[model samples]
Target chain A: MDLDILINSLRNYDGITRKNFIRGATQILDETYNIGGRTALGFGDDASALDIGNDTLLLMAADGMWGRLIEGDPRWAGYCSVLVNVNDIAAMGGVPMGMTNVISVNKEDICNEIMLGIKEGVEKFGIPMVGGHIHPDTPYTALDVSITGIVGKDDVITSCGAKIGDSVIIGMDLDGRQHPKFPLNWDTTSHKTPELVQSQITVMNSIAKKHLLTAGKDISNPGILGTLGMLLEASGVGAIVELEKIPRNKKVSWDEWLKVYPGSGFVLTSKEENVKECIEMLQEVNITSQVAGIITEDKKLNLRHDNQEKVVFDFNHDIIMGIKEERS
Target chain B: MDLDILINSLRNYDGITRKNFIRGATQILDETYNIGGRTALGFGDDASALDIGNDTLLLMAADGMWGRLIEGDPRWAGYCSVLVNVNDIAAMGGVPMGMTNVISVNKEDICNEIMLGIKEGVEKFGIPMVGGHIHPDTPYTALDVSITGIVGKDDVITSCGAKIGDSVIIGMDLDGRQHPKFPLNWDTTSHKTPELVQSQITVMNSIAKKHLLTAGKDISNPGILGTLGMLLEASGVGAIVELEKIPRNKKVSWDEWLKVYPGSGFVLTSKEENVKECIEMLQEVNITSQVAGIITEDKKLNLRHDNQEKVVFDFNHDIIMGIKEERS
Candidate 1:
């Protein structure tokens, strides 16, 4: 593979570029993100954390379905909505609790399909869809879901904790197919048993309690490398990842495989001494895990393949959700 | 005032009628709303409660901005989003912990204005807006916000707890004008000191801890009588309210006052013996309070004005969010 071509494709992909808006949006609330002083982590993590007393922190996250996804298949959109939110809490090493959604659709049939999909997701994830608001007469169809989870205050994982020389681990459920309608979606959980699907979530909490990883994030719309770049940006560090060492499904080419959002996938970082146990635990849960790279103090993400290396994101110049983690 | 016309206007008011879709939407998840048995209160409440251990329940609720309101005044729409979600927690007698939002807007100027409004709201209410997702390229402008709060499990005030013969109290800040852009918005907290505005919320928690109210709910888009109808529907009970006894700002006509979404307002049900103390506590926070009605066993909400009585909602036939609170 031509390293330059692959690097450019990953850097310019819409999944990665669409994140440009977050920096500007978050900057608007920079002063108040920690206004109450209880914000344990904010703005730059899979879920925001607030110190809620009793040695626990409340984790909150929200996601809006892409309009195209909603229009093409409302059911998948609704199902994916729950999938994404659950993954967010898991990425933070928190137990999934409950979710609420705001669904704006005008057609009764479409609404039912969406709700049915949500019900399936709830059953699969073992989380409740407790309460929400519905806009019955909107001119468009949209689904926005927000979730809340709890984690031990000291055990909560954050995107900003990667240290130099730490090993970068990429874990994914490879037993999946690319969704025909939405090619970027790696369909894994739908075909798996609820027992297996739920186990994937609980495993993260166990890893957190054991202090297995220094930092972690769920692979989302930004693909694997793009998501890693975000973690690097938040941590104010970087890494050199060997392309061939990354885990992949044989059916998909490297370019496409890197971009597909797997039903259960995470990019994690841990000290070299802890990497083996972390990988072993992930494998027991059926997640294909491997140490693909090493964290670096230099703020640049470099991809290497075929004895060639190309810089995908030089944080000094390239911006992806530009806000760095602000420690108080 | 013509009681029939006022009743008809409120019955058909879009704010109340728009809620018709919740029943069908929630019914889809009827089998799974309490999937894990952690759900303490699900549908038919301002916020859903889950048993989060430590004698506490985690409260979650979400609200979406009205499309027309966002189109008319994005700033006010943003501000109201926070106000509405915060009130959802307060109605359940919980301490507002934090909030997250999903903002979908295409215009930069509009997005900034909305964020400014959110920032203002965060500062005023003293609850931090910790994290959110922004959809910067959507065709429509919509803001959906969700809040997480903590409350003692035993101290929660729910809409389903109102008992027959309980006195119904309507509490609102009557010292505000109608918003210039949205006539139905009673602008209460925008001009008040944060101390007074936040006190209104903390007072609800005090009432809950003291076990002053049998049930409570924040008066929302449905206005006074319409909100009462929802509470009555949830409790499987009805009420007889004297129109003149409801505290109101004289500037707004009875027709308009009954439909305005006040920034700080609640509909509460308490035993007759607790009515005096409840009203006194509400008054201490600048919220005008008075006992305006009595709960009844009949499944109907009746309003009396000038000695003429009219049925606003007969739950036996009329459906406003048809799902009633199912106690397990």
Candidate 2:
């Protein structure tokens, strides 16, 4: 395999390149993101954290599916909407609670399909899609869902909490197939039992409550390595990930596998001693996890495959979300 | 004023009538609204309340600006988006913490104007616009914003809390002009100081913390009387509102004032003994308040002007949102 070709393809992939825009957009709103002095964690995390009274924090996040996907499958768009929001809350180590969505569509049939998917997602995840305003008539189709969750101020796991010497681990369900319509989407929950899917969520909370991980994030859009890059950026840390060690299904190419939006996956960082327990807990719930790397203070994300190393993201010059979420 | 014509106009008004579609839409998803059983309050309230742990609740709400307003003035639409979300939180007697928006626009000029207005609004309300997805290219322009706030478990004030014999209080900033672009929009915050606008939000928290009000809601699309009707419906109660007693800007006719969307306005119900304190608290923030009516056991919204009382909405027969919003 040509390293140059691999690097260029990854750089041009919409999933990775689209993140560049997020960096610019987040910078413009940084000042207001912390207005009133209540924003505990702003951009660079799955959700923004706001401090409430009594050592409780509110985790809030919003996601809008790509228009292409909504046009292709409104039902999938709706289901993914819930899937993404729940992952956001789980990523924060916050107990997933409720969500609200605003969907605008021109066709009732599409709307019906979307709602059906949303209903199934809600029942499976056991989190409600409580209240929202719907635009019944619009020229195009769009769906956006925002969720709110609760976490103890001290127990919350943030993407910015990773520290040097922390072990980088990836936990993902390898028993998934590519969504026929959306190849980049790995549909895992569609085949899993509700109990199993919910267990996947509860385990994340258990890990957080146990104070096992120093930093973590749900794997999303940019996929495994890209997600790790974001967490490293947020924590102001770096890592050297062994590409061969990342859990994989083998049926898909590394390039495609690294980009699929998995149904249940997370990138976590735990101290050297806690890594074993963290992986064991996730594996008990069917999540295949392995220590993929070690966090470092180098400010560079080094990837090693076949003993050939490449810098995926160099924080010295690269900006993923451009927001350094490290609190200390 | 011709009562027939006035009533007909209001019934036909897009602001008042568009909500009629809400019931049909919300019904399809009501089963999922409480899927996880964490949703303490759902549809029809200013915000959805989620029961998080440690006796704290997360309030979430969404609002979409009228497309006509976005077309006429993107800036106003943007500003109103922030104002409306803040009111949603305040209506819950929760702190106006932060907001996220999904904006669909194709024109650069319109997007810039919207952002500028949002920036001004964020600074004015002292709340962050932390994260939102943008639809860069859509056939039409639309804006939907959702906010998350923290309210104590016991301190939350819901629209479903009214009871018989409660004094109905109407609070509004009766010091604004009709928007040139959107005549029905009562523009109060455009000329006010940020300090004053923020204070308007805090006063509601005071009433809630003091446990004075039985129920409260922010005045929205359906206008003052229309909004009051929903609150009464949600609380499983009714009211007899004296039209002449409703607060209004003298310059604007009674009908127009009642229909205008005030920058800061609310409808609250409290026991007779708590009326004075509620009124006093609202007045401190320049929100003119008065005992304009009284809650009753009947399910009819009766409006009286010149002793000729007219039954505007008989919940026993007519439906506003149609969904009874019975939070069991």
Candidate 3:
């Protein structure tokens, strides 16, 4: 594989580039992100956390379904809406309690299909879709869902805790197929039993409670390396990832496999001593795991393959989300 | 004013009629609304509550901006987004902790204006907007916000708790003008001090702590009578409201006043014995309060003016949201 070519493709990928808008928007409200002084984590994580007293933190996150996805398949969009939000909470090592949605669609049939998909997701995850607002006369179709969860204040995992020498672990459920309609979606949970699907979710909380990882984030639209780059940016550090060590489903090529959003995937950082146990616990839940890289103090994400190394993101110049953790 | 004409206009008002779609959408997800048995309150309330242990309930609610409002004025749409979600928590007698938003816009300038409005709202309410997702390449401009708050489990004031003989109280800040861009928006908080504005929010918590009201809901897009109609519908009961007894700003005609979405307005139900204390507490925060009606067992919301009575909504026939409180 041409390391330089692969690096460039991932760097210029739309999944990663679309995140540029976030820094500008968040910068506009920078002064008040923690106005009440109870914000334990904000802006740069999978979910923000507020210190709600009682040794507990409330985690909140929101996601907007891509318009193309909604138009092409409203059912999948709605189903993924729940999938993504629940993943956000799970990524933070919190047990998601409930979700609320705002759905705007012009057709009754489409809305019903979307709701059916949401019902399936709610039952699969064991979380409730308690309340929401619907705009039935809108000219466009859209779905936005927000979720809330709770975690022990000290047990909460953040994106900014990666240390210089920590081992980078990539975990993914490889027993899945690429969704035919949306090629980048790795469909793992749809056919799985609810017992197994739910166990995959609770495993994160178990890892959190055990203090197994220093930092972690779910692999999203930005793909695996891009998501790791975001964690690096937030942590003010970088990583040296051995491309071949990364876990992958054999059916997909390296380029496409790196970009696919798996139903259960996470980029985690842990002390070398904890890596063995973390990988073991994840494997018990059917998530294939491996130590793929090491964290570095240098602010650049370097990809190694075929005895060649290419810098995918030099944080000094390349910006993805561009938000560094500011909490002391 | 002819009572029949006034009633007909309110019945067909877009704000109230738009809610009809919610029933069908919610019905599709009916079985899982309380999936995990943690849901203490679900549909038919300002905010859904989940018993998160420790005698505390986590409250959540979401709202989508009207497409026309966003098209005409993105700033107000952004500000109202926060106002509406915060009010949802306040009406549930919870302390507003934090909010998350999903903003999809095609124009940079419009996005900036909307962010500015959100910033202003955050500072004004003293509640933080900690995190959000942005869809910068969408074909339309839309904003959806969700909020999380906390209240004691035993202290929650629900819309389903109104007793048959309870007095219906209408509380609103009558010292404001209609918004220049949106005539239906009663601009109360924009010109007020943050200290006073925030006090209005906390006063509801005080009432809840004291167990002053049997039920409550914030008046939203559906003006006074329309909102009252919804409350009656949710409570599985009806009300008889004396039109003139409802506190109002004299500048707005009865027709217009009944439909304006005030920045701070609420419809509450209290026992006759607690009416004096509830009104006194509301008055402390500059919200004008009055006993406007009485809850009844008959499923009809009747409005009386100048001794002529008219049925605004016969719950047996009319369906505003059509969701009755089903929690036994």
Q: What is the TM-score of each candidate against the true structure?
A: 0.99, 0.94, 0.99
lDDT, candidate 1, B264-305, per-residue tens: 999999999999999999999999999999999999999998
How accurate locally, in lDDT, is each candidate?
Answer: 0.93, 0.85, 0.92
Error of 1 at B230 (Å): 0.3
iRMSD for each candidate structure, in the order shown: 0.7, 1.7, 0.7
Interface RMSD for candidate 3 relative to the native interface: 0.7
True-vs-predicted CA distance for residue B325, candidate 3, Å: 0.8
What proportion of true contacts does candidate 2 retain? 0.64
Candidate 2 per-residue lDDT, tens place, A115-191, comes to 88888888888888888887766677888898888788888889998889999999999999999999889999998
Summarize candidate 1's per-residue lDDT along A1-328 as a digit string, tens digits: 7877888898889999989999888788888888777899888899999998889999999999999998898898889999999999999999988999999999999999899989999999999999999999889999999999999998998999999999999999999999999989999999999999999999999999999999999999999999999999999999999988899999999889989999999999999999999999999999999999999999999998888888999999999889789545
Task: Rank the candidate models, highest lDDT first.
Answer: 1, 3, 2
Stretches of model 1 off by over 4 angstroms after superposition:
none
Model 1 chain A, poorest ten-residue lDDT window?
A: A319-328
Stretches of candidate 2 off by over 4 Å are B105-112, B135-140
lDDT of 3 at B36: 79
As a whole number from 0 to 100, the lDDT of residue A95 in candidate 1 is 92
